[model samples]
Target: MIEFVFHTDDVARVRFAFSPLWELVRGLRVLADPSRHALHLPWVHAVRPKLRGLDVGFLRSAVPATDYIPDFLTPPPGTPLPDFAAELEIVRATPPEVVAEELRLTERGGAAGAARRAMAAEPARTLEAVCVQLGRFWSAAVEPYWERIRDLLEGDVLRRTRALAANGAEGVFADLHPAVRWHGGTLFVDRRWDYRGELAGRGLLLVPSVFVWPQVSVMVPPYQPMLSYPPYGVATLWESSPAAPPDALAALIGRRRAELLLALGSPASTTELSRRLNVTPGAISQHLGVLRACGLVTGHRLGRRVLYTRTRAGDALAESPSVQ
Candidate 1:
């Protein structure tokens, strides 16, 4: 079990952020063993062919089958939403000593160990190679679907932040995951090892990831205290196409608008809607304007993005038996 003791100030400091780098690192695990990460099989099938010519041997070795992933590869995001380039720079700048220490810890007796040893021997050189490979991997595999993935992650943060505001930390922790628990002033994470750390008023960073499903990862001292868990609705992330809206609703709102409403079952941004529906952002904005005017949808500003969701009336219409 891992426990993080929080003070009153720490509670107020708890914040949420999105990490593209985290997704890329965790994605490597999913790609390494598609069978264990069945939810991402659709992604694996699509990405494997793209990665055929890329040499990810060092990258693959860094993420062993065990839970220990080299910390240098995934530094917690410093901002709420950092692009891949910003995060990659952080990785590129990791101190050589830190790299050697982490690699040493990752070392074990096997093929993976040999890779780790080689990396430890020349930290700076190996780190650059890892970064280069990561850049290529991201372009081919993650960047293509980032819009959809970011939408899901953003929606999750919005939901959880609201929960935190309405019901405090307890509310957010209630359904976070089976392995996580909160009691009094301490947060507990069930893990193979035991550890205790204090927030020390730095609070904690809550990161929602698309690929860390069915498992939650925690970071401790020498790094920002953070937790990465699968965001809600990740299971449906790779669906080839959206479900068709009810025929009656489609006829009433026009098929395009109805499809937009159905997609808003969870909050989403204009960019997300555009990408998911294969519609232009301009078209999506026009339709959203109509939906808003009709009292069928509402938008809320979360950071730089405004997320749209169905209003109560819109929910009724979407769920009405007559519409089905």
Candidate 2:
């Protein structure tokens, strides 16, 4: 069992902000009579544990722990995060669109396919605990994302979120996060998901909410958690990035492969790339093979699919033709 520490101060802050958030949620529950409400219930339920996980992450980050998840996966402390109203509207804006897309996914092979693949990734008990831990660990630091969304989500979303903020106060959670409670230090935890075997055997992935939001998420080898609320017809679809350090690499190597690299900028499955580039999987494989050999690209295995990413070499190649 993973050891967990809870601070009294953290609890007080959480109770302050969360109590009201819950109240608003309860108010939203009144609309349960509609089909859309039914659709949303499961997502709300699924997010509860993740939200709590984020809160725990925030607390741990404050202790200045060495084991830290990346900042993007978890929100930074003291950041004014997005509240429910904004999220509700974001969902509403494209609710039908998302629903239709999900339905289409189901028509093909998607979450259900992935979930089925993930079943044996860990022992049943371990799997259940991980799911719980994922949520508990995440909520502690879920704010930065909320804040990013708050600033980015405007128009219809802004109006509704502001209305809720007016009722709940915009800065409600400003002081609720543990990061704000204690002295500042670098806080991180392992948000990376681990599977015992090869990624392909278990539907491997990395889902940065950014993938969906800012579209920052990329699938790489080494499985990332799979979030689901099938009952609600909500499923996340991610394009995987090869786990070759695009961030570090993109900066290190930025020019030689600029055209080839940028052409491959969006996340993709091996098969998808083959089709898009008008190349055979084997031909694409040859290019990726050479790239990987040169450290110019990296390959990540996800659920029987391999996603290729441009490595520092590739990024450097992109950075300049003179890098060589």
lDDT of each: 0.87, 0.32
Residue-wise C-alpha lDDT for candidate 2, range 167-249, written one tens digit per residue: 33223222222211112211111223322222223321111122122111122223332211011001211112222323444
lDDT tens readout by residue for model 1, 1-324 = 999998877878899998999999889999887777899999999998999878866688777655478888888787766789989999999999999878878334233367788888899998998999999999999999888888888888887888899888897888999999999989999987778989996779999998888899898875789988888778768866578998999999999999999888878889888877999999999999999999999998866888898888999999999998
Q: What lDDT does candidate 2 reach at residue 134?
A: 36
**Which pairs clash in model 1?**
none
Candidate 1 clash total? 0
| Most accurate candidate by lDDT | 1
Give the Cα RMSD of candidate 2.
21.9
TM-score of 2: 0.26
